[model samples]
Target: MNLEAIRAIYKFEMNRTFRTPLQSIIAPVISTSLYFVVFGAAIGSRITEIEGVSYGAFIVPGLIMMMILTQSVSNGSFGIYFPKFTGTIYELLSAPVSYFEVVLGYVGAAATKSMILGILVLLTAGFFVPLRIEHPVFMALFLVLTALTFSLVGFIIGILAKGMEQLQTVPLLVIMPLTFLGGTFYSINVLPEIWQTISLANPVLYLVSGFRWSFYGISDVDVSVSLVMIGIFLAACIGVVGWIFRTGYRLKS
Candidate 1:
């Protein structure tokens, strides 16, 4: 399985993170903390609870999901993109490593970083609001699955990107808006009936709903539907990655 090859790549990517702790770790943590401060203070004053959960507590899952999605994409995309940018990818390609091993290394490392950040944000939330997990196991499952799925998506974006601008395009233009509008700070049920239906089409809603369900046993969407959506996305990403490797799409160029 080329375990050593996978480990080497994983360690290299991870070391890059450690080398830029301010940009890679501290910056996101600070940004999320600001969300808690602004939203928790401003909105909490007006809306005390949503579905019997405090305004501050209600947003935790969504915020964590938001961070996980963005960071997973960022980490995964940059990890592979840097090598491509510097023309080092050819060396890795020439190594005695299989495509699966290469993907496992990059995506696995990205997911690990996202998970760590998610946990840190979760813990950081405790200081801002009272928190509880009705189903800890399911919460962890959602966390891991969301991280892994988006990490794979990021890997695809990395391979497809032609420049730094293209690499940042999806996460900024697409993901961020979907997340903010996807019931992050407020419940979709509060929206107009039409908007609520529209919100259902945004995939981030399912992730936030399912994660919130795991925490408070309340959700805007069915937990099963959320799980199914995540599985579908995961499978789609794996398919794309497999096709990329087989065709040597950008890698061989």
Candidate 2:
């Protein structure tokens, strides 16, 4: 609500992120490089082209989504968690800043980190395989929306979390499993009819499918459906997080 306060918190979080370049920057780059080597090169070689694209190239969108999802989640979660751990959160709660400002600050920085890593991984993928951008605008839109959605989810986890362990729980326990099962490396079309139907239940599958569509002008799933799912997820995250802040779910005793 307060634009100045939101901007101030946003700038503060961005500066804090820069101070620790390793967590915000280096780690994602390293992890993405390893993924490009192992999954994109090693395993990709064993499999031939899928949907008329090389296996390495085909997985690029998935890898980018994976990096963006993890970075946004981790950054936003920790951004709130550390402030609470250090007692700065009490100051924030007492400040004139609204809950929207707090989330916008932390979530914006987290999304920026995800975008940076997404671009980096895209570049890295190019080194291994020829890269193409079939729909640049849609690709950018999906990336931003996915980043914002996960950032909000991370903010909720951060607010609800009581300790550092809880901060790691969501991504490790939930996001990871969902991503692997989301048709990241392989399309659901290759699976049995039942498994294919099950894969459709996964939200991450829609994200991966939509992103792949941007790259190759083709996808196993409908792009509009993916966009709609992401929209719903984003709305749900924002609504729940807003409720948590208003009710002081975990922030106030």
Candidate 1 per-residue lDDT, tens place, 3-108, comes to: 9999999999999899989998989988997897788867787886888898988999999999999999999999999999998888898999999999999999
TM-score of each candidate?
Answer: 0.98, 0.96
How far off is residue 128 in model 1, in Å? Answer: 0.9
Best by lDDT: 1
lDDT of 2 by residue, 170-245 (tens): 9999898888889778888999999999999999999999999999877879999999999999999999988998
Clashes of 1: 0
Clashing pairs for model 2 are none
- Candidate 2 regions off by >4 Å? none
Where's the lowest-lDDT run of ten residues in candidate 1?
40-49
Among all candidates shown, the one with the greatest TM-score: 1
